[model samples]
Target: MSSSLIFTFIFTLCLLSSCFSSSASLHNATDENVTLRPQHEIQKLKLIREHLQKINKPTVKTIQDPKHGHWWLQFGSGTLVGYWPVSLFTHLMEHGNMVQFGGEIVNTKPGGSHTSTQMGSGHFAGEGFGKASYFRNLEMVDWDNTLIPTANLRVLADHPNCYDIRGGVNRVWGNYFYYGGPGKNSKCP
Candidate 1:
C-alpha cells in the first residue's frame, strides 16, 4: 500500500479504538452498580434532600448591578446552617435520566446576565458568567461519602466563611472535587 494510504488506515483504526473505549467506559459507568445501586442512589439523594428540611430557607437580600447584572447574594443576615459542603457532593440525577446533575447553572445565551433560582432543595441562584460543559454518566459525592456537608454555619459577610464561586465557563465548571475553595473566612482546615 502507498504510504499515504497506510497512514490514513492507521489513523482511522486509532480513532475507532478510542471511540470504542470511551463507549465501553460509559457503558460500565451506567450499569446501576457504578456509583450506588438503584436503591442506594435513591437513598443518598433522599438524604441530601432531607437536609433541606432543617434549613429555614432564609431569603437573604439580593443585590444586582444595573449595568452588568452582577448579582451579589447577601447571606449575612443570620447564622444559617445546612448540609452543603464547600466541596464535591452528590447531586442526584433526574428520574430516569442518563446524566447526573452538578452544581452548575449556565447562561447559554451570549451576554446573558441574570440570577435565577435553581430547581432543588435549597435556594440557589447565581449570575451567569459564560457557557457550560456537562459530563455524561458521572456522579457527584461529598467529603464523607454521604451527600451534602453538615454542620456548616456560614457567615457570608465575613468573606472567610463564604466562597467566591465561579463556573459555567469553558475551562472551569463545578466544585471540581474540592479544589475550589472554602472561602477566605471558612473554618475548613
Candidate 2:
C-alpha cells in the first residue's frame, strides 16, 4: 500500500477505538452514579446501628412527624453532617422580630479528637412589613482554632404563615437531621 494510504488507515482505526472507549466510560459512569446513593444509605444505616450498639441505646427505626422545607444548614465531621429545616426558621420568623437560635453540643467521635462547635442566629422584620425579612448568621471554629463568624440576609414575600416545622438537633452531636421526605433515606451515619 502507498505510504499516505497506510497512514490514513492507521488514523481511522485509532479514531474508532477512541470513540468506543469514551462511550463505554460514559455508560459506566452513569451506572455508578445511580448506585452510589443507595449504597451510601445502606452504609449510613449500618453505622447508626453500630453506634446504637456501642451506646446501649434502643434502635428507633423511625421518626414520627418529620419536617419538610426548602432552606437548610448542615455541618459535620467525617460522614455525619448536621441539617436545619427551613420551616422552623419560618415559624420563628413569624412569631418574633429579633431571634437568636443556638444548639448545644451533645456528642463527639474519634475520642480525644477536638469537636468543632457551630452557632446560627437569625431575625425577621416586624409585622405589617407586609412581608418577612429574614437574616441568618453563622459562627464556627477555623483551622487555627480561631472563631470565625459570617452573616447573610434574605427577604421572602411569599412565605406561608401556617406551616409546621419539625425535626430537632440530634442529642448526640448537635447535628440537625431533617425528616418528612422519603422515609429514613435522608439520614446520616
Candidate 3:
C-alpha cells in the first residue's frame, strides 16, 4: 500500500534471494554419496542453521479473493517466497498512478562527509553499456494487467555529482536506462 512498505518488501526479497543463493553455493558435493569431514559437516550445518535463523519469515496470510488477484514474490531459484492480496493496497485496487525503478544508497558514516560508496556500477551513466549500470527491456503492467512499454518516462537523480541517471530507447534494449556512479568524488563532495 504505502511506498515505504513496498520498498521494504522489495528489499527483503532481494536479501532473501541473495542469502539463499550464497548459502546454497556452500554445498560443493558433486556426487550424492560424497561425504564431508565430520568437523566440516558440523560447521556447514551450523552455518546453515545461523542463516536460516537470520532469514525473516514471510508475514503473508492466505486471503481468498475471487474478484481481485494477488501479488507474488519469488526467488531467482524459482522458489515462491510469499504472496499478498492486491486488496491490501488501496491505491493499486484499480490501477497504480505512479511507478518507479531505481537504486539508492545510505551514508553509513556519522559525520556530514559523504561515504565513498559506489551506487551501481561505480561508473557514470555516460560511460554506457558494459561500463555503467543499466536496466533494459523495461515494461509496465497497465490497468488491464497487460504488459506494455513505458511511455513519457522521466528520469531524476538526487545527487547528480555522486550518482546520475540517463534514460533512452533503442531497437536492442527497447526502453532502457543507464545509471549510477562513484560516490564521494571531488565534484560530489
Query: What is the Cα-based lDDT of residue 7 in candidate 1?
Result: 8
lDDT of 1: 0.25
Better of 1 and 3 by TM-score: 3
Which lDDT values do the candidates have, in the order given? 0.25, 0.25, 0.61
The window of 10 residues in a row where model 1 has the poorest summed lDDT is 4-13
lDDT of 2 by residue, 121-187 (tens): 1112232111221112223333332333423322222221211112233335232221111111112
Badly placed stretches (over 4 Å) of model 2 are 1-48, 51-139, 146-165, 169-172, 183-189
- Number of clashing residue pairs in every model? 6, 1, 0
lDDT, candidate 1, 1-189, per-residue tens: 111100000021123234334223212221455532223435433433343233332223223223333323343343232322212212221111122222432334343433232212222123221111111112222322222211222222212122222222222322221111222121421
The digit string of per-residue lDDT tens for model 3 on 1-189 reads: 353224322342234235444334443223556433323445644544443344332222122233656655553333566767786775555555566777898886667777788877578999986567666666665555455777887899988999999999878667878888999999977
Per-residue error (Å), model 3, residue 175: 0.9
Work out candidate 2's RMSD over C-alphas.
26.4
What number of backbone clashes does candidate 1 have, counting pairs of residues 3 or more apart or in separate chains?
A: 6
Query: Highest lDDT, which number?
Result: 3
RMSD of 3: 9.6
- The count of residue-pair clashes in candidate 3 stands at 0
